[model samples]
Target: MENEQKTYRIDGFSCANCAKTFEKNVKNIKSVENAEVNFGASKITITGDATVQQIEKAGAFEKLKVVDKNQPKPEKQSFFKKHREVLISGLFMLLGFALIIINDGQNAITTGTFLISIIIGGYQMFWTGINNLSKLRFDMKTLMTIAVIGAALIGEWPEAAVVVVLFAVSESLERYSMEKARASIQSLMEIAPNTAVIKTPAGNKELPVEDVRIGDIMIIKPGDKLSMDGVIQSGSTNINQAAITGEALPAPKSAGDDVFAGTLNQSGYLEVEVTKNNEDTTLAKIIQLVEEAQQERAPAQHFVDQFAKYYTPAIMVAALLVAIIPPLLFGASWATWVYQGLAVLVVGCPCALVISTPIAIVSAIGNAANRGVLIKGGVYLETIGQSRTIAFDKTGTLTEGHPHVTDFMTYGDYDREAVLALSAALESKSEHPLAASILDFTESEDVEYSTIHIDDFKAETGKGITGTIDCKIYSIGKPENFDDADAYQSEGKTVMIIKENNTVIGLFAVIDPLRESSKAAIEKLHKMGSRTAMLTGDNEKTAGAIAGTLGIDTVYAGLMPEDKLDAIKNMQSDHKVTMVGDGINDAPALATADIGIAMGKGTDTALETADVALMGNDISQLPFTVNLSKRTLRIIKANITFSLVIKLIALLLVIPGWLTLWIAILSDIGATLIVALNGMRLLRVKE
Candidate 1:
């Protein structure tokens, strides 16, 4: 049988290190050819004939769970059920302390209560620890279990009970913090409606989204959330697309306009024909991409993971040495050294450090996705943080892309209308982009022109066109092909010359205008210390005019696709370059740059090829994305540093005999909470 890959969501998968260990064990199973565990998303994927039973067996050592990805999540437990052991352990600890205070540490009840707390709180840890210890797999749980058991063996019952109770609380808080970090992504799942009203031949019928097929007409009322991607067939409305594209204002949608799933129809009643099914909707793609992006670890995260693999065992050795060497060689007090060893074990868990980078990455990516930007991975997000040079593609990126007739000049009393009509009549037969723009302009102006048959029509690729109308030969070519080309070229406009029997009749100057946001976005990039450049295939005059208008720092004009790619590479030699394009002709440059950002309106090839995508084709979001990335990286660094500093302080305390079991556990828990909350701050980043 061919090996098929299956993904399963693993319940109770809180520890990143434990997930790594589980993946290794699962991969060892005879039926499994490969296994990958995504600690951030709590998912495991396996290839070959690996059954859930085999997966469960692999993770059974740590009490990890394996469930099919298609299965709905189990119902949440009540508060008591969720933290039964912790609450029970806490009560026992309190009773023990109370008895100790009441009886002055002399009663059997005090000792019994402490012993009960240790048994209740530490049993789960003890079982898993012993299992892993037997297999020589030492982890945080194993360290805590040893600390508690060793303290008890030395007659420190109260201390052991306190360690057990505190450890339980720490585990609970860690799980809660991770859940908080993941909540951003979980919220995205609720955006799309589960049921949609479909228009049938007889009437409209409400059906599950899965049952809705392509080409089905959907009837949407005011305030109805769109259930699938479709085009408006009739009626007009304003749609709140903030959920998908993050456009702040509701977009006005009319006939033939496309509406995405998960956006609300805010104003009017409408009928839309579904263009895609539920699974293929834009909202579905965003969710999947966001989840997958979170799963790919960052460079810093990989380093921490590799460091942690050895960190635990090394700590174990150090703790053992601290317990035995001082007592044996230095003749130090056995109890003192042993207590210090237990403290070291408590400080060695690595929970905060393991999670420091991933939490920030997940939060930043989720926040970016929610704000109409899709960053593909942590590495690219990090790359954006360090970028210093931004190179923009001129047409369709920095400019409106649709050229218009800016100036029309007529010679010898020939009216502008006459020249325009003749040019439109000749250009109507062409399928060029410029031709479409001309047709649109003429149609919008309601220009009247006679359609006359022209024979012997010929188009030159770089110069212009030639045709014979009514036995009269007319040539329309570049301004340089006529006499007044430089005057139009000086104004940064593309000039076309029209002649009657080889005598110049008139000229038209067409130009693609700058986008409204181009100037502001470039200014923001410059303020952020990014040098801006415009790369275009247009003439130097046109490119320079745009660069001057937009205040771009540099310009590379008259370049082909290959030249653009080469320019990107040359720029990368000194500075980290970011290339922004519509993602079609700029494919090679986008690939060659350190990072590529594609506009949402670009072709699918562009969106697929670029590292980041700006939805709604808004360049204004680019500066915000850069700031967000920098902020995210800063937070991640702060988290890692904070974790290390806390651990370092705790370790130093072992020298002064000031590190207590409760203090050690609290420090680790405190660092974990701080980092998680700090990472979650990314969700609130704004312009």
Candidate 2:
């Protein structure tokens, strides 16, 4: 039988390099067919058979622990406990310094104390580095190990000890930053309750979410967070959906309304019928997608990885020449040149450069997820940031998606209420799409039409409906039957005529209204230097009206699916265009655009197809996502540039032979910390 693939949480990784090492080691296992480590998520996936003990042993160099991915996370250790080895090493180093001062020079006791400190603090680094060295792998660990061992062989005991302790501290700092970045996903995972109060056949019993099947009724009370994706079967409430949509306001929900797991029921009691299993819940899918997103390498990350692959070996060769050439050509002291070469090796660790892009990518994606923007990958994030044009699908994207009565006018001898009441009563019996709008309008006007009854109702396709009310004949139908229909159609409204005994009495003009946030969102996009366009299947007039109202730069009206795709392709000829749509109907255009953004309330197809999802279903999040993506791109460039510049400056110190082990290691540590902290700033980005 074939072994199934599984993913497990991993602990004890100190840096991205360690994660790489662990992943490589796991892949080397005899029974494991494949292995991948998600450094940002601190999780490992293995294909084929591998026992927990076997996987743990693969990471033994780092004392890595493997746990079930679904298990509750272990409580955090205190700083001292977490860094015990480094702390112990530091204590011994301090003792060595004390001894050196007492003796007024380097001696046996101080040397032994420093040696103990180095062994304690750098054993893992040395072990992994030496193992990698044997295999001709020159990762950061191998470079640091070679540098530290060289420093010791040259009798620089105190500096070597300090280097070891400082390196460990730097790795610790890297781990902490990764943890902080991962915390966004962790917080999301913790949002929904683990169990739910299930209404069972025997009695109401609280059960684990996984044990609750579809059709199970979940009882949620005020202040309770829903534990399943379900529909409200009974009662009503206001739900705070910040966990799912990042919307601050509490949404009102009544019977038959949908509710998602992780959302809080702010008021009222609800018996919700479960619609999805625990692992299939929207929250679960978000967590899964976010984790998968972290695993994808951005274009910048690919460049950095390739650069580092060549860069590390080049540094080694340069260091070799620096050590031998000066001594052979100019009769410089071998010890001095060799020491400088080792310093060069230490300076070229690539700690910061290796992490510059991924940390930033992780931070940005995690932050976006927290804000209810599900950016699918770093590539999408970068594309969105670089996009110059944003194209929107008109109906559900920019408009209310359904028609509403926008204008009502009455003619001679008929009062507005009397005409509305008769029309509403007649239309209520018709099953046309426009009928709902008429009934909705009547309700909004507070007209007593529901109590009015219609008799002898007859519908005509593409024409109108006729009925008798209060012993009088009433007719409502397409505006083509009325002479004054041109005025409404010219304004992009659907006109319906109401007549008494075949004489026009009133007219109802309907149109799908724009979303309240659409205009402001478009203006914000324009201010941010993005040009906007609209693509719709609606006629030229309707599409032009909406485009004009929103100040859009271009409009592609009467577009079929292929036409929308062609429009996107055409737009790409001039600029990078992002297609924003309801996801299903716009899939072709979305797939063709530079980036695809879908409204969260859209179908599952939308969620899976789009490069990004605005969970609030409001375009207001569009400008925010663009701002975030642009900011993330800027920060990534800054991080890579800063890391390279710092390395260049440190390497230049070789001109005067001013570079020392202390200065080289400190530069690496400083650059690593700066890059990490800078990447973390994405977490603070707000709308």
Displacement of residue 608 (Cα, Å) in model 1 is 1.5
Cα lDDT tens digits, model 2, 321-375, are 9899999999999999999999999999898988788889988999988888898
lDDT of 1 by residue, 1-687 (tens): 679998887877666766777898899998888988877677888898777778888888556787653557778999999889889988999988888888787467787898898888888789878877898988888898899888888787888888888878777776776677677776777888888999988898999998999999999999999999999999999999988777889999999999988999999999999999898888888877777888767788878878888999999998898888888998999998998898899888898998788878878888888888888888888999798899999878888878887777889977777667777777876654467666666677788765667788887654567888889887776655354666666676777778989788987778887889999999988888889988987667767777888999989987867889999988988889999998776888998999999888412453477999887788988999999988988998898899989998998998777888778888988887888789888878996
lDDT of each: 0.83, 0.88
As a TM-score, model 2 comes out at 0.89
Where does the lowest 10-residue lDDT sum fall in candidate 2? 600-609
TM-scores for all candidates?
0.91, 0.89
Error of 2 at 512 (Å): 1.6
240: Cα error in model 1, Å: 0.8
